[model samples]
Target: MRKRDLEIIKHLEMFRVMSRDDIVDLHFKHLKNPIGNANTVLKRLVRDGQIEVSTMHSPYLYFPVGNHIKKNSTKIPHYLKLVQVYKDLCEIEPPTEFIIEPQYKKGLAEPDIYCVFKGTPLFIEVQNSIYSSKQMEDKIKRYELLKQSELVKPFPTIIMITNTRYAIESDQIKVIQTPSIAHLIHKANEDSNTPPPPQPIKTNGNITFKL
Candidate 1:
């Protein structure tokens, strides 16, 4: 797949699952380059089975090849930014799923980027600020509480992607990765046996303010 293609899918997979509006929102995120390409790529991925496509017509439903979406502590618009980053990374491997809005009552409240790498649930947060420390810690605690669920996994990481640093509760259980958008896009893919195609040279979007 092209780097852009992988990136788009990476973003698509971030939702618990997505509807048509979600896709349109993403179209602005990564597919402003041209027309028709988004639909074409979606069809191809569905045929390849790397992604799941649900035909709801008025609101198309799409998901990664998984049965369910995971947990996160972000809203949809906010999470889309993080998802874009993950998509760039998926030029090689699928980013583990993350839910920005943790569902509760259904009992999900640790809304960070949670992943099971090597059998551990690593919860990551890309923080641009420390003003929300206490509330963020509460989310971590909720993660621990929710880990008791047979459906929930344990082990978490709360990454803060920031320009400045601040203290966080050490007792709640978390780890931090400092701000690094290691655009290793070319690097990560090159490391893989399969390298993603080079991004097409372009300059049109530089003159615009995208949503």
Candidate 2:
């Protein structure tokens, strides 16, 4: 199997589902013709039985061969939002790489995405709802407790991306609202004094369709 095909399978197995556009954005953004190349690859993958597609939605979604996608499920919408955040991060310049739901030996806490930027490991959480003061405190406490144990060397920067305008800040964590995903990425990059990523060069010749 090709490396891209393997990556797609691993992503589907980890996230359960993703739309065609999501896949294109996340993996092929650097290509001269991203969407066109992605469509060609996806078609070949579907024909080879390595992946499957669902036409129940407008843009259509792709899934692992053996997995059944529940289009009507409430969880799917939230999952897609998380995927979008991942996709947006992928599109950012300077090329941010992420590990989904990191595993720790200390406990069972799994943050949505663990990304490292400018040598800083950041735990990013996507919050779709408001949290009570107590609820928020408990989460902070849990992270603090984990840090104190020193089970994971070098404490990570915890960042919460939320839909709410209100935010929380402390020595242990920082919360930023999600007015725009690209803006959020730019803010983080600026705060770290990291340079923006170079733009992809547009091809003047005919775009090749790779499968």
Candidate 3:
């Protein structure tokens, strides 16, 4: 019934599931005894039928009431990763908008996350496992098609986070392949700060000024 409790439920509804630590870190970390406080509030929610808990995983996972996802669903880990990604981005700089698994037109791109950070939109693909070259190519092609369609105006830059680097290039849309969002943002900042390469001096008989 507290404000933070309501926000936790909202987060569950949006993210589908979150580990106990994730909830505590995001909501109760300000308290002197964060874990204890979180446990108390979460237990009350579970007792009142406001949320569901899965004890199968250590540091039990919590889900919104009426959630259809099975306790053992393989997608549980994937969603948890998204929650971590969201948390990381928040630490760097909170995103103005963040959506999970944004749906696009049929046969178009299916981005894992669509977020606006620092006034720029980004479509992120969190690859927990290595994707084959062909699979990567197919994914890029879908984004190209989506760009051509122009449904999402000011098309977002596509960022692929994977441990196994895949050689992916796209002219229609900017693509950044990195292991994490922090790396991507840091690289972008570095690139922006880098000075332009020196231009070659053109000497037409009497011209000696820098071009």
Candidate 4:
């Protein structure tokens, strides 16, 4: 198998789902005519049964061959959100050191985005749905245990990108709504003099800001 194709498969397995543009941005951006080349590569992979495509959505989605392919499962808001964050991180100057999803360790809690910059790990969770109080408490406790345990040295800051207006009570977690990629990248590159990302605005009969 080709090196780039192998990387694409690895990404599909890790991220669970992706779009053509996602694949292009991650792997082929440096190539000449990236979009066209990405299309050709994806078609070849699909023909070889190395990957499968889903046409149920507007912009078709792609997944590895062994994974279950269902129309309903094809669209995940959280996955899309992560992809957007990934794209934004890629644009940061000096670049993001690394972004990954952690494996399920014996005593470690898995986070949505395990982003590393300057050797610091930021455990980011993109919460699209509201969790009950008990659920929230249990999750916090798990992270707390992970922090106290000798699993990860120095631990990592947990940032929750939540959809609701929640007032959390955890010293280990920071909650925010609708965060920009630049802001996140800046957080990782603390000493770097990158300016703040532009905030988003809404237009519904009147102009408003997204906070």
Best by lDDT: 3
Clash-forming residue pairs, model 3: none
lDDT of each candidate versus the true structure = 0.55, 0.72, 0.90, 0.73
* Candidate 4, pairs of clashing residues: none
lDDT of 3: 0.90
Q: 1-211 in candidate 1: lDDT tens per residue? A: 8776676577665554555455555564366543356567677878998787656434555677874533222343345446554444444455455455455445445454555433445555665445576766675566656655535544455555555565655564565645543543444445796755555554665543232
Query: How much lDDT does candidate 4 score?
Result: 0.73
Off by over 4 Å in 4: 93-108, 132-134, 171-178, 186-211
**Model 4 over residues 121-148: C-alpha lDDT tens digits?**
6777777778988877777777777776
Worst 10 residues of 3 by lDDT: 202-211
TM-score of each: 0.44, 0.71, 0.88, 0.72
Residue ranges of candidate 3 with Cα displaced over 4 Å: 186-211
Q: After superposition, how far is residue 59 of candidate 3 from its true place, in Å?
A: 0.8
Window of ten residues with lowest summed lDDT in model 4: 92-101
Which stretches in model 1 have alpha-carbon errors above 4 Å?
1-36, 39-77, 96-100, 104-109, 117-120, 128-133, 136-140, 147-151, 180-211
